[model samples]
Target: MEKKVIGRRERITLPEWGLKMVTAKVDTGAYTSSIHCTYTEEREVDGVMTLFYRVLSPDNKKYKDKIIATSNYTQKKVKNSFGQAEVRYKVSTKVIMFEEEFDAEFTLTDRSKMRNAILIGRKMIQGKFLVDVAEVNLSLKSKK
Candidate 1:
């Protein structure tokens, strides 16, 4: 069987997070993908540290549906667009693109200030997609 190739900007459904249709910006420049989250909390379970967070969609409504994920690792001094360095937490999850699912790492951050909540970076798109800057959602149409 041949693997299906995904496009730059695609509509994705995060069922675990209760996100029906989310528009993600496929950025090859970013090493790790990121999602907009709010009310993030770090907790310990049986001596293992775990993270729980809520993803905020572009609609300005908080997806109270919490996702419990384990910390893959921590990154330090990540430079942002404004040249500001900040530390962020990284987590792993399965993302479905073009009806295909794959495990990918995502950095958790409050991206409410940004335009889109989810950003699909190069790490997640490698060998799976090709970006067309002029086109958006060329793969799947958003149900929202």
Candidate 2:
């Protein structure tokens, strides 16, 4: 398959979460992708263990404090910016970029301090995309 060229920064859509055009940083240095989560908790619902979480910030007009639950999740030990290993919940979800949908894995973390809510790491784009630092929002511009 031909690899698509993605900009250093681009707007992405998380259709399953009802999130659209969320700005994401394409970081080839990082090994795995991550999505910002203000809150996260695990609860036992009926006979199954369910994970409940909220995406983005409550200040955002569109997706504010909406509780999203999923049972398909696992814990992964990922290194933080400080190079410290931290255990975070890893969830498989669909991410739309360059008008193409792909199954991507994202680690849930608090990125309220970061500029972008989503971080597109190497794993998500491995063998699938090439990052070009010279451009930004290439996907959005293609739609125009």
Candidate 3:
């Protein structure tokens, strides 16, 4: 397999969830990737616990204010940027990388104050991409 090279920041899409051109920051320090989420609601749908949440804030230009649902998900304790451990929802989804699709696990958290809407951690980048410190948006460039 050919190694795909990406930059420090890349634009990724979650096509299955109707999201496009979502900005994601590549972080080698993080163990797992995460998506900015808010207004999370949990309800029993047909006797099964389901979660509904929105990705990114509505004020963001690419924001859709979409209410995404997931039946197969988990709540795990993860350390935040402040080094404080908190429980967050983990969901599996397909992410578009180098214009190819791959399965990725994302933890949902309220990143309203963060610069990027999504974060691609070390697990997602391992052996799949080479990072160039001087570059950004390599995925968007490849799409053209």
Candidate 4:
């Protein structure tokens, strides 16, 4: 299989959450992908424990103020930038990049201080893409 080339940074979409053109940084050093979440909570919905979370802040006019709820989530111990172990919520969502759709798992975390809201890790790009550090937005450019 020929792997597509992606840049160090690319635009992606989460169709299930109504998000488009979200900037995501490629981090080959990390194992699991992560997304910035405003907040996350566990509540009983329709008699089932559900995980609800919101992504991006209201300032991001294009996609904001939306809550995504699902029982299909898990918690895992992930290392932070400081290399400290922290348990974070992980969920699967449909990610669209370079016009290709695929299911990818993203860990929910408070990345308000980070430059980009999304971080695409090795796991998500492993078998599908090759990263070019000097390039950026290769996915979006491919459409032009």
Q: Between prediction 1 and prediction 3, which has the larger TM-score?
A: 3
> Residue by residue across 59-140, what tens digits does model 1's lDDT show?
5545555555665555545666567878877777777777777788778788878877788888887777767677777656
Worst 10 residues of 4 by lDDT: 56-65
What is candidate 3's CA lDDT for residue 74? Answer: 95
Cα-based lDDT for every prediction? 0.71, 0.91, 0.87, 0.92
What is the C-alpha local distance difference test score of candidate 3?
0.87
What is the TM-score of each predicted model, taking all chains together?
Answer: 0.80, 0.96, 0.92, 0.95
Candidate 2 lDDT (Cα, 0 to 1): 0.91
lDDT of 4 by residue, 23-114 (tens): 89999999999998988999988899899999887578765768899999999999998899999999999999988999999999988888
lDDT of model 1, residue 56:
70
Q: Which residue ranges in model 3 land beyond 4 Å of their true spot?
A: 61-64
By lDDT: ranked, best first = 4, 2, 3, 1
lDDT of 2 by residue, 1-144 (tens): 888888999999999999988899999889999988989999999989999999888899788868889999999999987799999999988999988899999999999888888999999999988889999998978778
User: By how many angstroms RMSD does model 1 differ from the true structure?
Assistant: 3.3
Mind giving the per-residue lDDT tens digits that candidate 3 earns over 48-109?
99999887787765555678898989998999999999999999899887778998989999
Which residue runs does candidate 2 get wrong by more than 4 Å? none
- Look at candidate 1 and tell me the lDDT of residue 11: 80
Which pairs, if any, clash in model 1? none
